[model samples]
Each structure stands twice: as structure tokens, then as C-alpha cells.
Target: MVQKVVIIGAGPAGLLLAHYLLRRCNYNIDIYERRRDPRLTDISSDRTFPISLQKRGRKAIQAIAGLEEAIAAQSVFCEGTILYGKKGKLRQIPRQNPVLTIDRNRLVSILLKHLNETSSPNQVKVHFNCECTAVDGTAKTVTLHPKEGDSFTADYDLLVGADGARSQVREYLAHNAGFTCSQNYVPDAYKSVFLSRLNPSAGVELEPNKIHVYNLNNQARMLMVPQPGDQLHGVIIFGAENNPLEGLSTKEEVHTFCQEKFPIFGQLMSLEEAEALLKRPVARVLTVRCDRFHEGDSMLLIGDAAHAVSPSIGQGCNSSLEDVLILGQLLEQYGDDWDQVLPKFSEQRVPDAHALRELSDYTFPRQKFLVVEFFLRTMVKRLFHRWFPDWVKPFVFDLVLDTDLPYSQVLSLSQGWINKVKRSST
Candidate 1:
């Protein structure tokens, strides 16, 4: 009998899982998403930011033949980052391995497109503008409410929640399955920002293969990643309580603000983009931590639904995709027995999730003194690791970004620095 698998939230996690499950040939998949289809909409800039996928996330996509190629076709890769300080003080940090970057909606759209093209309707059906309202584990059913239709119930052999940080499925698990979960909004809030990568008349062009980061004082920053077609897609991240654009009411005011704060990017910004910036919604970053990722054999949580962290370290989406990769391995190992896969996945992944929380929170020093020390240490480690590959360990940032080393081991190796940053902050 073919197993009916219902996945909640058609983001990258859910959609990617559909791809994995489709290959099994014994699972029929249905993915429900709350938002309108990305292919049918142009509002991604308001809600989605550019995502940088490193080795771990990239490898997961690479495992599925042709998946990475499709994504990379629309993506721009950066071999390094350019940090902009006051008065255009620039610092270039190079990487041996390039980071694959794409807008979030573009990534999801690519995944959905590939799924539709490659899988039959009998194998996978994706429904957008619908959301999971309730889960009845005892009944083996899930209730879904669509935007323009009546609520419906669907039976499933298994339920997977890839519904993002504010997941309704996770809510169900917490209330009924004794799952422990906590969510706290990180202090930062952000709005999508768009700009041309070049300003030809002024002879200024941001590097096409570099991540551009500019600190607009201590409380606000703009992090832009290059996109195809001379586009820069990113976010203006600021303190949620202390909005950097508090006095900015109109497009001109917002433009002037950017001009004063991040002059290099401001030079490339357009009046139209400033207007969009003023109209865009400010989204808060919510970090979620769960004690375990699975309830019973029938219900499991993956991706942001399981572990959400601050984007400071660029691991949120990477780790989310990795969740599916790990689950697929578990399914293979357990001989397709979900009962065996469920508990073991939690056992193997829960610790790594918790460890990721610590790393995401404290990996980057916020204090000025520690920030200098952080760079100095990174520089030293880079040099030492090159000279004595076996004797010196790579820095946590490099270990996390450049390699596919298990996060738990990365945490163990880098715990001392994490602790000091935590101590200093408190």
C-alpha cells in the first residue's frame, strides 16, 4: 500500500521533502502552503530575503540529481564578503568555497517547479493559499483551510510539519503530544531591500560575486547579496524596538536616511526602491527551540518548524534543508519504518539543533571590543589552519560555512569562544 504523506507548509523544507519522498515510490505526497504561489506573485521582495547556501545545504541539494543545477542556474555565487565600515573603509574576507545565493522565493519556486515537472500528480500534489488548521493524530487526519474554500480533512499515514517558525502543526504537537517548544523573537527586525548592483554613471558597482555588508551604526545594518540581472536583493536589519527609520515617513526621507547611513549602497539605490522600502512590512526574526522534533511515529517536524535560529550566521535555511537530508537517511536505515525513523531522528538531530541555537546566538560578538577580537581571532585561525592543517582547527565560522562537518562537533570545538561571547553579553 502506498503511504499517504501530508506535509504542511510548502516552503523549501516541505517541497524538498516531497522530492525526497517521491523518490521512495511508496509515498504519495501532498504539500499545503498558507501563502499564494510564488510563481504567480511578485511580492517576494516584501517577505523573502536572499539565502546563501553553504556546503551542508548545497550538498543536500546536490544529492538529488539536477536539483542543484536548476537552483544554481538562477543563483549567484559569492567567493567572499566585502565589509564596509565608516568612510568606505573596506575589508575583504575571501573564502575558498563559494556560497550559492538566491532569493528565498526564487529558491522555493525552483523547487516547486522541479517537483511539478518531474513528479506525477499521483505522486505529489501541492496546494498553495491553504494552511493546516488542526491535526488529529488519533484519527490519522489533518484539517486544512484554504483561502477561498471550506475547510477539509485529509487522511494521512504520516504528517510532516515544515511550516516555518510559527508552525500550526508544532502548536498541535505541543498541546496534544507533550512536545516542549519555545519561541522568542530576536531583537532584530528587517525589511526587504532592493538595489541595482551597479551605478554606472558614478563608476560605482558592488562586486557581483561578493556579499556586501554595511553597518549603519551599532543598531542597524544592510546586508545585500548579488542576484542575477544586475540586481541586489537583501534586507535592512535593525533593532525591532529601535527602528532606524523612525523619523522617515516618505520615500525621500527614507532615501536620505540610507544615504547618510550606508552611503555606498545608498549611491546605488533608486527612488523607486526607496518607495518600496517605505511600503514594505518590517518582519521580526523569531527563533524557535524544541526539546525534540517528533511526537509519535505518525507526526514529525522538520526545518524551521523544528529549529529556527537568528540569521546572523546564515545557517537557518541550510540547517532546515539538512533536516530532510537526515530524515531521508533515517528512512533508508530503518527500512522505511517510520516508527523507527521518528525517534532516531530526534535523538540524532535534537542535540545539534540545541547546539545551533548557542552558536547562532553568540557566534558573532556584538560589543565593539569583542568585535575587534573576533576578527583578529578569525584572521589568526585562517593563517594557522593553512600552515598547520592537522594541528590547528579552523574557526567556527569557517567550520560552519566552508565544511560539512557535523554541527555538534563544530559546537564542541568552538564552545570556549561561544561561552566567552555569552558571558560578555550578559
Candidate 2:
């Protein structure tokens, strides 16, 4: 008996879940996305940002044969990150393992492409421009509204909410199934930015294999990752209460502001991009925390819908992909019986998710003094760990980027640092 599985949101997690379920050959899949098909959209006009995938996320992609190579072909392998300070002062944090960075949409596209090529229409179907408005867990039905048609209902044997932070399925569970959840907007907002990696006329070129970060202050910063075609893509992040770009009224004003505050990137930005920056709406990140990820045997949530966190430590997507990987492992252990897999997944993952939230929120301090101390500590730990491998583990950043240690274990080992940063934040 092939169980029908309905997955909401055709993002990376949902599409990747389809790939995993297809391999099982005991489930037929349907994925509905609220946005237009990314493969048919203009890449330049996208408001999405690049995602850095380290070992945890990469390992999940590696599970699907050939998927990692296909994604790597479109990605840039970054050796380290360069942080720019005032007056062209900079600091470099090199990594032992190169991070694979790719645009979010591009990653989804690759996942979707592989899913389509491997599974026939009978095995899988993806519906775009369809929004999930409601869910009926008792009846195993979901209500979806299409962009061009009337609302409709579909039935599923198993329902997965990978619809992101604003998931309707999760909302339904909270309202109807006694699921405990909390949501809060992070204190920062951001605007997507794109620029050429090189400005030959000005003799200014960012390293093609390094992530570039420029901090104007505690209130404003930019982190750019190199993409194929000599393109640099990222976001200009600012505190919600203090948006630096608020006063800029015109494209020329925006351009001047960038030149004055972020000169190197200012040299790379075109007037057209400046205009786009002015017109682009500010995006705020909403973090979600739920006590558990599954409501019943047939209903489950994953990725951003289950445990959305600040991208401070850059684990948002990595953790989301890791969720799918863990779920796959559970299914294998339980022999694809969701009745056994769902509860075990929640029991196992909820604590790690909570720990990840703590790590993501406090690992990077906001205070200037703590920022200095943070870097020094990170450097000291990296060096000492080399000499005393058993006594000193790498810093939280290195541990996350370099290893696949359970997030809970990582949080436990770094609790003191996390506590100090948390206190400083207060």
C-alpha cells in the first residue's frame, strides 16, 4: 500500500524530503509551494540570499546520490571569511574545511530538478503558486488556494509542513492539536544586495573564494558571499530600531551612503543596484520555536516551520537540512512506519532545536567589548585545541562549521560562553 504524502512548500527541505521518500518507494508525494516556480523566474530579480552549507547540511545533500556534485557545480567553495573594519582594517578567519555557498533559490532548483528527474509524475508532483490555507488533521485533508483557481482540498495519508516559519499547517496544529509554539521577530532586518565581485577600473576586487563581511557598526553590517559569474550576493543587515538606510530618499543618496560607509563595496555597486536597493523592501526574520515537531502520527513539521532561528551563526539552512537527514534515519530505523517515526523524531530533535536557538542567539555577542573578546577567545581556542586536542575543543563557530557534532552536545560544551554572552545581552 503506497501512502500518499502531502508536503507543503517546495523549498529545499520539502523537495529534499520528496527525494528521500521517493527512494523508499512506499509513498507517493505532492509538494505545493506558495511562490512561483523558481526555475522559470529571473535570478536577478530574486530577493533571496546565499546560504553557506557546512558538514551537517552537506552530509544531508550527500545522502542523495549525485545531488551534492550537481549543487557544487553551481556553488562557490569559500575558504574563509574576511571581516572589514574601519579604515580598511581587516581580520581573517580561515576554516579547516571549505564551505559550499550557493544561492537559496539555486539550491532549491537543484533539489527540485533532481526530484523531478528521478521520480515520475505518478510518484511525485509539485504544484507552484499554491498556498496552503488550512489543515484538517482528523480527516487528513489540506485546503489550498491556487493563484489562478478556486480553493480546493486534498487528502493525504501523511502531511508534512515544510512551509517555512509562517506555515499554515503548524498554525493549524497550534490551534487544533495542542501544540505549543512561540514566535518572535529578531531585532534585525535586512535587504538583499548584489554586486560584481571585481571592480577592475578601481583596482578593487574581493577575494573570489572568501566570504566578505563589512561592519559599519553594531547597528549595521554586510556579509557577502561570492557566486558563480563573478557575482557577489548577500544582505545589508541592520537593527530594526536603527535602520541606516532609512534616511536615504534617492538612488544617488543611497549610492553616496554606501560609498561613504562601505567604500569597497560602494566601488562595486552600480547606480542601478543602488536604485534597486532603495526600492527593495526591508525583510525581517521571524524565529519560531515549538515544543514538538509532530502533532500526530500523520502530521509533522520540519525546517523553518519547526525551529526557525536567527541566521547569526549561519545554521538556519544547515539545521533545516539536518532535520531531513535525521528524519530519514528515523524512518529507516522504524521501517518507514510514521507512527513510530514521528514521536521519536520530536523527542530526539526538540532539545537540539532549543539548544541551537541558544547557540544561534548568543554565540556572537552584540556588544563591542564582547565582540573583541569573542574573536580573541575564538583564536585562542583554535590554537590551543591544536596542541591539546582532548582538553580544548574549537570555539563554537569552528565546532559548528567544522564538525557534525549534535547541536545539543555543542551547546553543552559551550554553555559558559553562551551564558556570558546572554548576560551581556541583558
Candidate 3:
């Protein structure tokens, strides 16, 4: 009998894995998403919160789409970051290997388009606006509720949960399937502001070639990434519990808080503009990590479902894509042997998962503080780039950006390299 594979969430991980699995395996696959069909509308109305698609994300897209030329056509190539330091010091920190930036909607549209074209379109059908409410891992069944109707049940040979943090699938597995998990909601809250073009001909407010950052100690950190067209999207992150504006009862209080916390921001924006955003509630960022990614044979989790890291490092999406890639490769290598493959997938990925979590935790507080260590590390990294080849930078970059490297091997190699540095320093 042919196996039935039901994947929850039509996000990057689920869609990419589906594309590969459908190509390699003959399983009957179906995808369910909580948002409405994006293809039906040109505008991305359902995506309130935006995501930035970096180079690794682009690589994953190219790998799944089977044509680098097609993917490249849709990308906005970014060299690196433009840092705005204290005393008005503006620095250009180039990545030894630059990455491209693609608009989130366009990337999702491309993935969906590719998935729609091959084999049975309905084989990987997306049930939109249908939220997965519950899962019975023991019975190999899932329950979902649509906007307009009653709850429905679907049975499958394998259930891949990519439903994101606060996942109902994870909850189901923990509650019913005896899976262990842990979730951490970092004390930081963030707000995004749109910097519209002054004039259509003015182009972007910031350079299209790099992400702009105003790293203002633990008080706050401001980042602006160029969106498609002339708009630049800015996000401001601050401590939630210690927020001075948390209990701002009136508009006047909000204005005072904004000016005090982000003076440069206040100088750039009109009081009305600042107040408009302050009137709205702030959004909290949470990081979720599970002790175990899978249990027995019936269920597994990936992406934010298994590990949701803070977006500070910008590795969350790339890491998720890597998870799908690694799992797909393993499944192909160990075909039809679920018993062997499942355990190995978990084992192979565990170290990477831990590494990603550590990186995520590292970035949040350091980026928050605008730490001297961060500045020193950045300077050292630049010097290292000048002295070494492409291979050298990716080694350090992999540790900072790609957490898919084995933790023990990474430690051993890093120590070996560092001892040479210690010898040289002496």
C-alpha cells in the first residue's frame, strides 16, 4: 500500500520538503495552511508580519525549484550590513560572500507555483484558512477547523508538523504521545514601522544593497531592511518587562517615551507618526525549543515547531530550510526503513538544533546591548577575511549563521584554530 504523508503548514519547510519528497517518494502528500490562498489575490493581505528571505533561503529555494536562473531573477542581492554607530560613525561591513534578499511574498508565491505545477496538483493540495486544532499521534490522525465550517479529520502514514511556535501539533505530541518540550518567551518586544518613499523617484530611504542598523545598547536596537519598491521596513526591539512605555495611559506619555528611548527615531518622524504606532500594542518575540524533535514513528516536527529561535540572528528561517534539506537527504538515503531513518534524522540534526539555539540566545542579548565584544568580534572577523580565503569566512559564518554544523566537530575545529591564534597573540 502507498503511504499517505500529511504535512501541516504551507510555510518554507513544509513546501520545500513536499517538493523533494514528491519527486523522490511516491507518497500521497497533502498540505494544510492557516492562511487564505495567496494566489487568489495579488496583494498579500494575510501576511501581517513580514519575513526577510536571505541567501541561505535563496539557496534552499534554488535547490527545490531546480533552476538558479529563475530564482535569481526574483532576488535583491545584498552585500552585507551598513552599521550606524555612536558618534555618527557609519561603517560598511561586507560579508566575504554576499547574500541576496527576496521579498517574502514573492518567495512564497514562487514555492507555491512550483508545487502547483507538478504531478497531481491535489496530491500536495493546500487547505487554506484551515487551522490544525489537534492531532492524535497514536491514531495517526489530525483535526483541523476551517473558517467557515466544522472540524475535520485526516489520517496519514506520517505527520510532519511545521505549524510554528505554540504549535498544536507539538502540544498534541507532548500531551498524548509522551514527547518532551520546552518553550522560552524572551523578554524582548518589537514594533515594525514602515518608512515610505518620500517620492516615487526618490527610491528607497536606505541603500537597497544592505540592511541598515542603529544598535543603541540594551535600551533599544533599530533595524531597517529594504522591501520591494521604495519602502523600507524598520523594526525596533526593547525589553518588554522594563519598558517605560508599557503603562503609558495617554498619548502624551507615549510621545515622551518614544523621544526618550529613540531620540534619533523621534527626530526622523513627525510626532503624529510616532504616536500612531505607540497607540497600537507592542508585539512580543518568543523562542521555543523542544528537547526531542520526534517520538516513535507516527509524528515529527521541524521549523519553528521543533525549534523557534529569536529572529535577532536571522537564522530561524535558514535553519528551518536546512532541517528540511537534511531530513529529505536522510529519508532518501534510508528509503522504506522508517525505523532506522527516523532515529538517525533526530540524531544528525540534534547537534545543529542545539547550535542554532545557542546562536539565537547569543545574538539577542549581545545585539540588544550593542556589546563591545560584538564590535571587537566584527573587527576581528573583518581582519580574518583579509588574511584568509572564502573557506575561512564560511567556517566562522557557518557557526554564526548556519547552525547545521555538528556541535562537537565545530568545537574541536574552532578550538584547534583558536589555539593557533593564542600562540600568535603571545
Cα lDDT, all candidates = 0.91, 0.93, 0.67
Shift of residue 405 alpha carbon in model 2, Å? 1.3
Poorly placed runs, candidate 3 (over 4 Å):
39-56, 66-72, 85-87, 103-106, 197-205, 242-281, 363-370, 385-398, 402-404, 407-426
Q: Residue 26: error of model 3 in Å?
A: 0.5
TM-score list, all predictions: 0.98, 0.98, 0.82
lDDT of 1: 0.91
- Worst lDDT 10-window in candidate 1: 39-48
Ordering by TM-score = 2, 1, 3
**Residue 86, candidate 2: alpha-carbon lDDT:** 92
lDDT of 3 by residue, 349-402 (tens): 777677666655543223323344455665676677567856454343445543
Q: After TM-score superposition, what is the CA distance of residue 49 in candidate 3 from its true location, in Å?
A: 5.0
Q: Give candidate 2's TM-score.
A: 0.98
RMSD of each: 1.1, 1.0, 4.9
